[model samples]
Target: MRGSGQIVNRRRMIAGAGAAVLGTLLPGGAGAGRATDNALLPKLTDGRHWRIGYAETMPYGNYAGTLASIVKGLDALSWLNGAARMPYDAGQTDSQALWRWLSAHDLGPRIRFVADGWYGGLDQAPAEPILQRLESGGDIDLMIVMGTIAGRKLAVDRHSVPTLVFSTTNAVAAGIVAAAEQSGRDHVWAHVDPQRYYRQLRIFHETFGFRRLGIAYENSPAGRAIASIADIEAMAGQLGYELVARHVQAPAGPDDQERYYADLAAAWSDLAQRVDAMYITFGRWSLDRFPALVRVFQERGIPTFSQLGPEEVAQGALMSVARGDFDGIGQFGASVIARLANGERLADMRQIYFDTPTIAWNLAVASRMGYRPAMSALLAADNIYTSLRAVP
Candidate 1:
């Protein structure tokens, strides 16, 4: 693994383009490194602040949390990493870092944070309320939809403003857009990773030779669509393995939370004994239960894998294929929004997907599970954790 100093240098390099773009957007053209002429830059009409709305399927869940991190990362780039030096001690989640940056910086006067909403675990946020808040008065110029469910509904409802969908496992399968290359909607563009799961599964099989893989599936339309099990099944069959899956029920209300964890724990107990390894799917209910689920699998000596990111692997998963640069997503999304705000047609914009995937490994969990990844796998890991603690 690279030294701390090397990693920091790499991060700055990866953030260079983003920081430059953000510099052009800051007040008074402060950090405008290349383009000093204000006329050449994009700006809101009449100096009106650009209002961006944030919507997620499960705002408090892991996927949403990661999306929030991407936003903070953008804020850091906007300020040339000045927000990172702020004295405030942000929480572990990206949402906290975003809150801190918003409080400490003058980003609001030029770029404002608008309506924030989340569809409950059951995909209950209908189109009317979303459209009413965003499209009714033209209060919001752009909306960032976090997951497939929220993006699907917003697209189906025909939101009038430009929309950027992020972190969706599969936009094509969910019918958010006709094809990744061509987003059938003029007002929407999305970032989709259709092969994330396939890549992770292939890596796990080649690394550990896990034949019977166990997974927890959420019972929801979005869950059914994104990361379809049929895809996993076909991949597993070709790879000479079997997929053992259990349907996990989504919590209908607050009272069902405890029961939901209990049911997941029970399922994990049975699955651990049968499967050689475990794969976690993108489900709000399943993700919420990760801490408990990771503990259960760890205790049973089962190596767990996921496509979520490095954070999950650090928490307890044996390994993961994570999005290489978290900040890059925010940077790219910001550029798209900047163009749209500058009168560029949304139909002319193409959807973006992260092609750089990094391997992350948790040596502590691998040791506990009595599994040794091949030397090649270890050498390929971009991020490695020796302890089962959150990545700071």
Candidate 2:
């Protein structure tokens, strides 16, 4: 039998060896006479320096995390200054801070960040102007789009600019891409893990054996994608658990964010009365409210799993499955960007990539629920929090 270390090494070899392995399979790759001397450096096909722009659904921690990791990956690949670091915390939901950092940072001679090009919250920002900028093509060589709303808007046939979509809950379900194998648009590529939520739900169910599971999400199309309701329902059918779901109004504006959370608070409070366990889905609510949000679940001794990541677990959720670090996903995305800049066709490149999952367990939250995890489970956790962080 193969050792656990052997299995892990094999997975890394399959997933993390992104550039070399993928290049061989795709068109205009190493075998197709693609240039390599300047491949790691960012440049346009016409020998002009690359200028990159960015867009997002809103100010989100996941976007911040994905951007930071991509920047770090580019630096490591020598495409940017390895000595520099992004200024904002990936755990914070501040897009302006990230834009300021990008504007000031020396990203190296190979690429330039268009200072006026960053946009946030597609729901609030007018889509036409953003679409026009991307369609111009000469304004920026590539657009780093984060989140489902922006991805759907920017990654259409109407705009021919190279667009890379990241940080979405499920890109395929959101209709940002056609499928995991291909993006179905010439200038679009998305990083996707179609089964990520399914894996999370399965892990949660197997651990706690909950007879009824609860979830909350917005009722709209975008909200369903974020909550992964289809995946949740499919898992329920297989695992023999009843699903209890609630819909809270999605914030209409920045000012409405508080009301949205209030609605969520009420929904979860109602759910707490009916469910065996709760699955906390993603929303734009400020992380500060996490402690209070999970307080109802804790008061009732219900186990909660956060869909966002271990960051939420650190705040208050009981457990989650997360990549041990963002490095692997970052490297995967960076390789795709570098290759695209090097003149590889986005259509030829593969879009499916999966992070090797590790358990993130919070001992304090578990203790509060009067649950003691198995010794083997405790030993397997990649991140174990002894206490919850103070609410920000």
Which 10-residue window in model 1 sums to the lowest lDDT? Answer: 26-35
Cα lDDT tens digits, model 2, 202-225, are 778878899999999988888898
TM-score of each: 0.75, 0.83
lDDT against the true structure, per candidate, is: 0.61, 0.76
Runs of candidate 2 with Cα error greater than 4 angstroms are: 1-46, 83-99, 123-125, 389-392
Model 2 error, position 74 (Å): 2.8
Worst 10 residues of 2 by lDDT: 1-10
- What is the TM-score (0 to 1) of candidate 1? 0.75
- 325, model 2: CA deviation in Å? 1.6
lDDT at 224, model 1 = 70
* Residue-level lDDT tens digits of model 1 in 301-383: 87788756665665677778744444456555655565666677766765644544556777778787777766555545556
